[model samples]
Target: MYKRVLLKLSGEFLSGDSGFGISPDTTADLARLVTGALGGTGVELAVVIGGGNLWRGARNGKGMDPATADYIGMLGTVMNAMALQDAMEATGQPTRVMTAIQMHAVAEPYIRRRAMRHLEKGRVVIFGGGNGAPFFTTDTTATLRALEIGADVVLMAKNQVDGVYDSDPRKNPDAVRLDHLSHREVVERRLEVMDATALTLCMDKGLPIVVFDLFQEGNLRRLLTGERVGTLIES
Candidate 1:
């Protein structure tokens, strides 16, 4: 059971089968899933979205400067935040899109107090723009935001992956699924949960993390209600 949770969603979740850009149908479906999960639950929610669907700075920035490419990726996340916000609101879920980079016309600037206030008021806060910095993945943004808002835990929602495995489950049928692990084990073993930076931060700050399948019906609600639906990584 958790009071407040920060959800980390990869951009690929918004892209659907195409795996390139945001799909309206897919986003709407995801929106419904998220809102439905929290419908009767009293848990507060915040989200940090990745930009990998629209842009992967390291993979797409062949000749351009890394920082510039990352900035471009941040913009992509803003686009995603707005789309999710629209879809969620249509489902009667009060949502707010806050950007780390100030774009007054599009989103509210990410202010720690303001975000916390929104959550207290029963609004789902969507954090976009990747912490308003370059070279930091959305993973880091999720961890950072979780810390700033004093969230009970960080929920890493994978597209379809149910949990962390000893090896790549898709490529290796023998890959073992790990249900529980220490943060140190995850970092030392180089598990593909979060980036090393994010893991280390959580380890240092004593933040618990849950990696689970976001598309699974009732998975989010179960996790929030203390039902173990996936991997649990913590100190």
Candidate 2:
């Protein structure tokens, strides 16, 4: 269903059993799942990872200066990016970590054209550092990259949940799960699936997004094969 995809993974998802920081085993599992989906297939992937496991610019540093807190959060994302890149490489998948901020020693600077070329050659590119500026979320970055790369869909690999619901399903057991929704519905309902800016960007670009549980084994493969296992946000 999709020749190219942009995968958005929250940093918390990488925290294996401990629920904080990068867990080698968990990252390895995710890498294996991603490679399994793309291996022997001509699918291209670009990954955008969040830093919530380490630090969230808004939630952390309540007393600290906003800029300092955001910078710390960006660094956290770089750390996760490196870990994911290593895990993917260990699984025999070619990967690259590109940062919005210039970090020549650790990653390449974000260049849309070069990233597209890498994808074209079957290399998975992981974008980190969240627009290299304060206030913009990684969700927005994922949407922007998806449009730049002409991805068929954005696979929002969430932790511990499958699909979008009218309310937090964990809290409200009776929350209705939505199999399909329009971007406008997400915005109008104020669903916290993604930031409003990100949702609007996808809406404007006409990019579909599939919000699914990354922890579910083989769910990524099912999504790539066009299985309607998650909430699809489209026109």
> Largest lDDT belongs to which candidate?
1
lDDT of 1 by residue, 34-115 (tens): 9999987889999999988999988999899999999999999999999999999999999999999999998999999999
Q: Per-residue lDDT tens digits of candidate 2, residues 1-235?
A: 6799999988987898787888989888878888887787678889999998899867788998998898889889999999999999998899999998888999999999999999998899999888888878889989988998789998898777899999999999999989999999999998878888889999998899999987688788787776777899999
TM-score, structure 1 vs. true:
0.98
Q: How accurate is candidate 1 locally (lDDT)?
A: 0.94
- Show the lowest summed lDDT stretch of 10 residues, model 1: 187-196
Computed on alpha carbons, the lDDT of every model, listed in order, comes to: 0.94, 0.88
Q: Name every residue pair that clashes in candidate 1.
A: none
Q: How do the predictions measure up, each by TM-score? A: 0.98, 0.95
Error of 1 at 163 (Å): 0.9
**Candidate 2 residue runs with Cα over 4 Å from true position:** none
Clashes of 2: 0
RMSD of 1: 0.8
